[model samples]
Target: MTVAVFDHEGPWTEEEYLALGETSQRVELFDGSLHVTPAPTPRHQRISRKLGNILETAAESVGLELLEAVNVRLRPGRVPVPDLVVTAPVDLDDPYIEAADVRLVCEIISPGNAATDNVLKMHYYAAAGIEWYLLVEQTTGTLRLYQKRGRHYVEHQAVKRGGVLNLSAPVRATIHPEDLVP
Candidate 1:
């Protein structure tokens, strides 16, 4: 008889993942294994860049700071690099990004990451207690907003192209989907 063994309790350190370096590779260390994703397509980059800029601008108006694709080590071996993250002001020597300090997290969904972003990532973000998460789908040109509710996030709204996405209170900006994609 054969029994399966899994590294369920992983206190995997950061150094292991960093060694792989940047090759347009998107990888998350889960249970001591590397879950790697391919480089995002051009359309993905456009939406991500636009969303980052828009969020940064809006956050600035409210006296907040935003970080782009910064590593937020949610747990020991579960680190997923979000497209953009908004956090409170950090000291120059702040070590790691944690879920507690994050105000918002946005992910630009690509054809390859639709299932992971919409399903897998959604659960992870909710489990980490991220306040807000926005998903921008490039193919559909749609923006979906989710706000933390109890232990999960309920879809706040789905904004289509040309529609305005109103920023949550304190951060005021109405962004049109077309403005983000093109």
Candidate 2:
């Protein structure tokens, strides 16, 4: 089910990328290239929901909003849909959330697209100046939090199942890795 719809013959424009995303499948544009990922597995959805709930509670305390699977425009030619994000109030009329407005971006690694979440997207989010990034490794049931330092992300916390992850930068919340794996 995971597939790439376009050949790397030419770079795609932001308009073109947005058009392609109109299809039923989920697609992300990174460095002018299109990457299509399969629908999330049940485990992926469950983990996302659990993390969203935890983030939601923290966001409520901080007066931010929690969004799931929303299109984030990191830049002109880069749009990555993060699994979950915490941001300031968004205007419904806007087409996509801007990177500057994002407080934290969370990606729950899909088995088929681990590299995209672990490496590519991490770099992109950092380059876009997103303050915080959370990566949940589905296979290992581990949670890794990264804070933007300079132009890249330096690992802040790495917690395995049964371990606790405490966040204080973007928001104040304590999450257990065991709660993230269903």
Candidate 3:
């Protein structure tokens, strides 16, 4: 990736944003602006890792690839790094995964960025034509699965901590919301 300085400016073009070098903080591009978030907490990381493991195993059974913290170029001027993603195999040399290759994108909501994950990112993913979007709420350990329908996403299933989320679209898997918690 080409390295350019981030000036904390607004209305950045996709080219300008991608040219910026990687920073310690997590960064995303949305609506021509850069949104930077602090590093996740230990509890968040643990939940992400556990969910990734579960998804990876299920993806492997169906010949899909499960990726964690991968930069997905949903569209020009819109790049969001989801917590976990399931996709068809991508070229190893590619700088970012194309939205077309993505089957499912997930975000494990952080307490500090709940709105971004639950609302902003959800709309972005749906607009990108991603088939499935999974939202994991950290506070309550709830898993919500959304399926794309035309220009929006509809809630397909919702499971609480004690319930099981059995998904049949994009891939097949039985996931427990409680297992996702640290």
Candidate 4:
């Protein structure tokens, strides 16, 4: 049986949020609120898996770890799950990862929430002190890498389908946008 998420009135606490347990949707906590994301399309999943494999290689080469869709507690009361996260290996059993340990966060832009990924998450990740942010644009088969500058992100690289994306920070990764789709 499914439980009603909004039965109580005030903002959700970490305890109350944790009580929700696992669900079919992607749920995140942002500023004492619950944000639910629909399960991604198969095409979106394919792209995420391919890009994850590519990121895995890079992360492993540098002795870091790559995790997919894990909760990252950015601050005292904010958490947002990114599509991919890279960091120094830590205990996987922990409730959530603290942002300071995170080296990078990546989001594969989704159709309904492109702006959220491009704007909201970019700012959120930066403010959380994550050093790198990578955005994948599936519709155009392109990728953009941004490096945190103070409280915001500055574009470090933009690669289209035919071009090669070479990243030197947070890890050294070589990605070809065309390979991300299939």
* C-alpha lDDT (0 to 100) for residue 37 of candidate 1: 73
Give the per-residue lDDT digits (tens) of candidate 1, residues 79-150. Answer: 788888888776635545877877888888888668988988888888888878889888878898899899
* Ranked by TM-score, top first: 4, 3, 2, 1
Candidate 3 lDDT tens digits, 36-72: 8888888889988998888888898898999988789
Q: Whole-model Cα lDDT per candidate?
A: 0.77, 0.88, 0.87, 0.88
Candidate 3 collision pairs: none
Runs in model 4 deviating more than 4 A are 1-6
Q: What is the lDDT of residue 133 in candidate 1?
A: 87
Score every model by TM-score. 0.85, 0.91, 0.91, 0.94
129 in model 1: Cα distance from truth in Å?
A: 0.9
Q: How good is model 2 by TM-score? A: 0.91
Which runs in model 3 stand beyond 4 Å of their true positions? 1-5, 8-10
State which candidate, 1 or 2, has the greater lDDT.
2
Candidate 4: tens digits of C-alpha lDDT, residues 33-82: 89888898998889889989988999999999999998898987788889
In candidate 2, the residue pairs with backbone N, CA or C atoms under 3 Å apart (3 or more residues apart, or in different chains) clash, namely none
TM-score of 3: 0.91
